[model samples]
Target chain A: MERLLFDLSIAIERGKENETSPYPPDLKGKPGAYEFTSRLLEMNCPPDTILKQGMMPGMDRIGKKFADGIVFIPEILIAAKAMKAAMTLLKPYFDNGAVLRKGKVIIGTVAGDLHDIGKNIVCMVLEGAGWEVFDLGVDVTKEKFLASLNEHPESIICMSALLTTTMREMEKSVTTIKQAFPQTKIYLGGAPLTSDFADKIGADGYFPDPHSLSKHLTGNL
Target chain B: MINKTFRFSTESLLPDISLILIEMGYSIPLADHYLSDLINDTLQQVRKHTRVQAGFIMLPKDSIKTQSNILFENRLLFEPGSIIMSQLQNVTSLAVFLATLGSDFDLWIKFVQQIDMLQAFVIDTIGSLMVEKAVDLLEEQISMQAMIRAEKCTNRFSPGYCQWLVDEQHQLFHLLPADFDWVKLQPSCLMTPLKSISGIIGLGKNVIKIPYHCAFCDNKSCYRRLKNRKGQ
Candidate 1:
């Protein structure tokens, strides 16, 4: 079971969606994450086991690879897509509370920024890491962020931006939330944002890559 | 002796330029360094590929300008506007390499070889061309709409340029796509392509028109210009 789980994780990391998927030429014709995930379900493996042992580990490897620069964006996108495919099969279990999420996170690209690539990656990694993410999408306003916060009060907030101008909106949103809820921890991230910039903006934390952010969040929680 | 020749057109790749750069091993932060080398290599390749009196134009600061013209297409939240400026004198250098389309045989062979170098050479060359073309298109578009030469771009200013600070990257984010392929800028205004650029242009008059040689300039804080001078 452990070996099967490990193999599934590798398949997902390599973007092996199924036997028919042609990407990662080396893995052609092999059963992908989709097949193995369904097989696990059919074999009566627990949903939590599949998630903890299969999906999570897969995303973790992909995230680590991204951080180390072994894989580039196209590869990461494929992995994220494969992980998403597997996650769909497990959604029912999560909804039924058989697999409880460790926590919830409110994520979005701040207003004036139409960028979603980084935000989507983080959302995928965070979801694979076992968080129930409330994606606010691109160009989210402060009101939307605050509304989401009100709805999911226990959730942490993550702000994403891809432009120098939109980063200002991130600062504004964080400031607005902190002023209203002093205990609310805000995480800031994006290509242009550094640890120093995060501190300057008064955010709770900053991460260079999605995997690091996932580890940081789960480690503390 | 690097004798390899490569080339690609920028006609269909205005927006996705950064994505191509990432695939070429040029990260956004390291883009400038690779760009300098790419430019040099491209010039050499052009020389070998065709016989044309190819040269580049290094605009002075005084010739560039920044003009802003707002346009409302729909009721979208963003009030779109173009920032036009004269970037003439401020241009550290604008070197262009042109090679006539060579004999069909050499052109075809070189083109195929260029495809193989896409991850290394073609991307940067295309990126440089796109940026230059973008500026030119922007200039022409702004001029046509404004009914005048709006402003001159003093120089191409990117993140971490001189003492301008990298934090300013946030300002440029509002102008670009959030997730441009693998090249996304985070909330902090950092670009993912790792080979992208951001810079400033002083519009209007009173702009300084300095020569290409950095040895004659008094601004000691100019990083790239100073580096070039030292190499000489």
Candidate 2:
């Protein structure tokens, strides 16, 4: 069982979705995250344990490599793909309360910003790290954020913006959301964003990449 | 004003996979078959969804005007900050350019996002490179045309970079012809069809093309910065 878990972690780290996946040539033709996860489930391994041990570690490894600039988006993305394959089989367990996520996060590109690539990447990384993410998509206004917050109360908020002009919308949304949920942590990401700007705008954090954000979310940073 | 448009088939503007990989953060050689296959598959999809619509207009030197942040024709006030103004101060003319992979690419990316986020991301990166490549081709044509008149081209500058307020895109749009239909700017100045680029390139005898100016710009995550990163 431990060997299978270790194999699953390696599969997720290398982006092996299944036995036939041709990625990470070194691991090609081997049983992947999907198969290892299936085997773990058949052995009655708890879904939470599989997620915490088999999946998160792999994701955490890739995320750290990404933060360190040792791995890039393609690598992180493939790892996320492998993790998603495993998550598909475990979704039922999560829905049935057998598996628990780390926390809830609501994310979006601030109003007037149409770019979602960065926001989507963060959402995937957060989900892979076991956060239940609520994606608000692009051009999300303050009203929409508050509405979503009302629905998913106590959830952390993450906002993205690619344009300096649209950053004002982020500030407005941050101010509005903070007013309604003062304790709700809000994080910002984007090309134009900075830690100083995050501080200036009353945001809790600013992460340049998804890995750092995940680390902070998991209290590993 | 000299205005021209082009509609290149997707085959002509296909971005180099190596360059795309570099932009995606891979510094090593292209030995990863997974990314290779994905990029190939995505390029196939790109061919189906992309039709590059690009064009440019050149405004005469006298028609151009400037101040601290720079102004065009005593109209469009561009707050492009000192970095861009200092470079543009020597330009004899300005070439406003627009390029897009069209609505099909946007629609395809959205559709794929619902099914496969990884593919969507790959396609998004490729689309960015494609649009920039289209602009590069257009710039080449502009350069060739300008060379006939003994003029040179400087690096293109967009409103969202070099401290230029993105809202100035609205003003830039006004300088184009009424029927200039290659791309559209939203009320927020975010270009529609998503994978689109609009900007100004300096044209003159004294204007010199500054290489790798990303170091001078603050937008750390700019796509060009990643593409131009050392070893990439």
Candidate 3:
């Protein structure tokens, strides 16, 4: 069982989806995360164990590689693809309360900013790292964020803005959300964002990439 | 001279898969079959689905004024900075331009995101490259038009780049014709289609186009920084 779990982790880290998935040439035609996850479930393995051992390790490895710059966006994306394949099989378990996620994350692009690729990437990484994420989509107002937080209290708030012009909107939204929920932790990311900018906006954290945010959320930073 | 507009089909842009791959951080030789297929498929989708639109208006030689940090035209000013100002110093004229892949391209990306995240990313990257290619064509056209008058083109600079405050986009939009609706700038000054590029290019005998030096900028999350680092 341990060996199978380890193999599942490798499959995910290498971005092997299944026997037919041709990515990562060396892993082509090998049993992938999909198959490994199915087999683990058939063996009556606990859903939490499969997720914590088999999946989280893979996400952690890829996230570290991303932070270290050993890997790029495509690699992280493919790893995310594999992780999604596994997650699809584990959804029922998650829905039935057989597994517990680390925490909830509410992510969105601030108002006047239509960009979502960076935000989506963070959503995938956070979900892969065992967080339940509520994506509020593009051009989200502070009111929308507050409403979402009202639905999922104690959730970490993450905002993305790709344009410097829209950074003002982000600052406004952050201020409003913080005022409404003083205990909420707000994180910011995007091409034009920096830790200094986050600090100036009273955000709890800023990550240049999704992996750093994941690391921080997991308390590994 | 009247302001001009040009619309291009994807065929004219000649999207370069290899160049896009390089920008996506993949070496040509290392772009394996999967990546190659992925890029090719996305390119096809982009060609079939994207609406590549670009337009530019020329400001004649004497109508423009410049200070150390301000580009003054039509009694409006944009503070791009010392670096951009220095680059624009020798221009006899300026071309204010806008380019976009239109909203359909964005719709396709949003649709793909619901199904495949990696493919959606590829589509998004390709969409960006396509808009840039469209802008490149517009710049070349402006340069060609300038060449007829014995003028050369300087490297293009956008409001959100090279120390230019993004808020200046509002000022840049004001320079366009009132009827110009190819791209709409939001109240925040970001374009509506979201995958749009707007900027100015200088044309003159002494305005030489040089490689963009990312080292002088401090936008650490700038993808150009990664591309530059990769080149090193």
CA lDDT, every model vs. true structure: 0.60, 0.84, 0.83
lDDT of 2 by residue, B147-202 (tens): 97688888888888777778889878877655466567877788888888889988
**Count of clashes, each model:** 66, 0, 0
Highest DockQ, which number?
A: 3
Which pairs of residues have clashing backbones in candidate 3? Answer: none
Worst lDDT run of 10 residues, candidate 2 chain B, spans B223-232
Model 3 lDDT, residue B58, Cα: 79
Give a tens-digit lDDT track for model 3, residues B104-210.
98788888988887788888778777788899899888888888868888888898787788788887887775445757888888886877899988777776777
Clashes of 1: 66
Native contacts matched by each model: 0.05, 0.62, 0.81
Residue A36 displacement in candidate 2 (angstroms): 1.3
lDDT of 2 at A123: 86
Write the number of the candidate with greater lDDT, choosing between 2 and 3. 2
Model 3, CA-based lDDT: 0.83
lDDT of predicted model 2: 0.84
